[model samples]
Target: MTKYYFLLFLFLLAGESFAQNNLDSLVQIRGFAIAAPRPDGLPDFIKFVNEELAPRKVNTLILRVDYNYRFESHPELRDSVTLSKKDVRKLVDACKKQGIAIIPQINLLGHQSWAEKTENLLKVYPDFDETPWVKMPAKGEYKWPNPDGLYCKSYCPLHPGVHKVVFELVDEIMEAFEAKAFHAGMDEVFYLGEDKCPRCAGRDKAVLFANEVQKIRDHLAMKNQELWIWGDRLIDGRTTGIGLWAASYNHTYPAIDLIPRDVIICDWQYTRDNQTAVYFAMKGLRVVTCSWNRPEIALQQVDSHVRSRDLSNKELKGRFYGLAHTVWSGPTPFLKGYYANTQDPKDGDKTPWNTFKVMFEKIGKLETGH
Candidate 1:
């Protein structure tokens, strides 16, 4: 009888695992990220969760483990100031207790800078430097404000040694957090064929994108894990000259069919209500509608995402997934103050994070028109 009970226990555990996987089946999962640093130099993400998420039923969080600054994992010297292991563990534990899926983001190819004065990555990989279309002759440099004392010049994708270093970054995060899915950022692939780099000079942009994506996919596959990437360049077909450098601003990509359809595409529009969400759905890809965090920028993004979802239902027989809002740069003082003041609002633009929770719940209501 004891042996029979042990067999039953194993069977029950397997069923439980299966059921948990099914929980993500119907689509439309909500998520947030600690991308922007708050005024106190610490992201108030945990506070946001305690004060906002628990009440609203948000269950997924994406923490960007690597931002403008370099972590210890960098092959070159490490940044002394980095988030501690203890804090990361605390974050994971807190989210787990709330039943949230934590997906940490590590930029693989671009957005490497944290500060202009310091050399976090650009100094290490000088060959990857891009000649900006709008050059500053006086400064003899063309880089954006890397407010956090980090570097920005992206590592050259064609550089053989860079892969090993990037892989180390990804490995460190996966090992530390034990997250199931890794977000390998392949966004904003500018500097593709800067005159200085011979390896990329004449290569077709689409092929270049596919090549980099495949490298990431292969690396993740070896680790028995899956990868998610932003989906703009791929949508711009090869014929359209829609590489990351310019495609994003125009919201034009070739076609989705040519790229690996299995990958989840985050179709985002921040300025206006759009049908791109519906277009992505019709392409048979998993779509997550993204809204921006800027109070001025977020409402239109939120309305766009919500409207897109509704349109998808009517236009294509596509599966509706969920909502996500991206907060770019360190938490701007204006936005941060707005959120702090309005977090417990009786009215006004609830922070984009707040908007996401509300929009996500509305996805369920859409079916019944509640």
Candidate 2:
């Protein structure tokens, strides 16, 4: 009887140790929520914080606020319906109390388009267009998945005066949110080295690409902030199916090798095994997997992040961080309880990020006991 009791104690200790190891592996579970600064949107966005985001053990929010911020530096760049600096401060204080990091996303290197539906950057400065003569399409002129849609304009990275305006805009957004890191939206930059642009023409595409990323990284470094960008642009499209999505247009690989080692890569893969996350991890850059609006995909991404950590390779160890699931489509649902997404295909119409949020919460609670 004494021997039996001794063996049981050993078994219980081993089990607890295993649980700790599993929990320690994941650093954070984040939501990529975009905040619309309108009056109607602010209430829901705040509710998303107090109700959904706080309870779930979701410690980070990579908010893509866009031009919704009221900018003192660039008044023309802000939308007519924008969040006042005070409004953002309230959310920041609220989020701080809940122990969540509010990282603001600003469109930096690419994403300048305005036909019918408008984006503010290039809508205000047309000469900033990378391909000014590509014949900008009227809003809704191109159907979804149209490669012509790939022609969405980008500002010339080589333009002499572009970064002056870009830096001021970034400074305003970062200061307003009191952000620790900045997400420079440098994905799907399709128009590099175009003949229509005088500055970018005949430039080596790879040098041009790495230079743009380094410029942003260096700018953020001055203020002692970290730089983050989507991993799609760094992925090798020919090998990875990620090429099929927004684009593999420039196919910038080996280029990831050129940027600062401290820069975080937000590797978003909606479908496929997200081998890109592993590849980035292997390269010694800190990486996190991002999921789009699907439950099964989010589960697989979390699993992939875990399985990647389980590998024996020393270079692949430790630098791989956490997972962030995106909530792009809206009205953003304000959920009551924190629950992880399951394998059921017909699960009620929650966005992929919501499902992923619950999934992370479930895993995170086991570790932090939150």
Candidate 3:
């Protein structure tokens, strides 16, 4: 009788293990990183989320506000058409109901301006510029991403005034949105530790990179928030193809081993670089795959992400946090083109934009399937 009871107990234990091995054990993060809505377009943007994104299970948003908030610390940084506190509050409330997490992003390191003559933070606070004396390219000569253009101005991370205001800006945004995670726009930092700056001259580029990441992470830790950053600059260009938008700062990836593992890396790959996710995950950092412009490629990459996590390996399991569809060009044009256009004229299939939108909608339906 004892032997029989032992055999039955083993059978029940095996059944329990089998049940745990199913798909539900896998984790998925469905997120969207979008541009901050203009004040006039706020209502339409909110309505679109209620009507579309919520139904589609887009549970997270990485909003690129880029000094678009009326800051209490420094009003000078606020753009002419910044989002009011009420607007941010309203967005937070709306996201809460949809089970979505909103992480507001401020361009911390790169993207001082989109174009050569564009004006922004670095242009306003000249002292913060890492290579302030570096002349702007002469009339479209050696434009951005050329490695010599030095298009995007990086603030001297060592400057005292830099963090004083940036931290205040971060504090205000996190408080406004009640965010648990904050995305620091730290990609494409080309002008780091330049010889021009008295403060940062001759400093190790990797140390500068790692120090800045830790500084941001420490600030977030004070509020019990997690730090999220673009994984492009962290990638080694030798093994991976660093694109135009994501420029490597002279191979500063050695900083990866220096920073904390809890920092969530949003590993965005528009091409076959989806394999890069494993590099981050293997290093013990949480990761999310990001895509934009190419829906088929996005879908394929995301599929690969899920499949990688579903494997039996201990390191691979539960590392891929989720998939994020980053619509860098705001939803207005995307929606307009999606509504007016069908598949590509040449290919006779839906445009990449439409294909991506449809995928989100399908996921929403699947989430609430009857």
Candidate 4:
């Protein structure tokens, strides 16, 4: 009877081990770090990675190399600007040392402007400007605001030549950094089937995205690489309301199965109640929860969101990959200003420097039930 009991216990342990490994393989820890800050008082991106990010078992760093503020229209602007190759190298080296892979994120489809300060890429490739929202008035200036409040000039996804340009840019970035995964910025793609574009007028919105995703996926696959995309646009109508959320929202568009399953879905919600991660995972897609640097309220939200997602999803419990905290330098543009905002004592005294610290402490409590 003791032998029988021992044999049953061994089988149960093996089953648990298999389940744990399966979940761990799917859960990727996504993070956004200041990889290429301007020259003035650049924080050692490497030091931060080594000291902060690595210990958290963060497997992926979504390095923000955005062009809207850093460089516009001319990719060549990267040459004149502040972030250097050496800075990138240091970060990449640190990432390698820490066993974390870098997936460099360049804003490709939209979020293409910091303001009118930089010349628009759409201006150079007018054929590629896919936004039906923006009517090019007779005077040639883009129709301001475009009915929607968000300021975005979308590149036409239908244009074959546009893919060529995008591929070229992707190729350049891939060659420069040698990262295995590339984050194809497909967030908030409002202009799915543009009204004026004859090429896009009659196509299904879901099909349009699927085709586009396939195009990038095929390109990356050829180069022996993979792609990661935002999960907002892929929520299926059957499981959830299709138009339940505003079009601007991450979960606003179609079904998860619309895109290829291989593509990583960055399930993101900056709100305190981060229920989106659970929904995404339930749909049989991999998920990564994302948060941003906000006020003290934001950290409270993150804590709540993390706990909700982690505890609520039992089948996907260990499958709940990890969390991503973004340090956005938008309103707070300067480094000191950003540091102050994230470091504000009210922020649970938890800045980016201390996020991992808090995370582990919470994790320890979760593990210990203390």
Q: Rate the local accuracy (lDDT) of all candidates.
A: 0.57, 0.72, 0.76, 0.59
lDDT of 3: 0.76
Give the clashing residue pairs of candidate 3, or none: 29-322, 343-349, 343-350
Model 2 Cα lDDT, one tens digit per residue, 280-349: 8778888877776666777777677776777636666666778776665433442322233323365564
lDDT of 4 by residue, 90-157 (tens): 65777788878888776666655433422245655676767544544433454545554435556767
Question: What are the RMSDs of all candidates, in order?
Answer: 7.8, 5.2, 6.4, 7.3
Ranking by lDDT: 3, 2, 4, 1
lDDT, residue 20, model 1: 45
For candidate 3, which ten residues in a row score worst on lDDT? 361-370
lDDT of 1 by residue, 275-329 (tens): 4556677777767666654444444544555565555555343344666666564
Q: What is the lDDT of residue 345 in candidate 2?
A: 62
Order the candidate numbers by TM-score, best to worst.
Answer: 3, 2, 4, 1
- Residue 364, candidate 4: Cα error in Å is 6.1
Steric overlap count per candidate = 15, 4, 3, 7
Compared with the true structure, model 4 gives a TM-score of: 0.72
* lDDT, residue 366, model 3: 31
Output the better candidate (1/4) by TM-score: 4
Candidate 4 CA-lDDT value: 0.59
**Top lDDT model:** 3
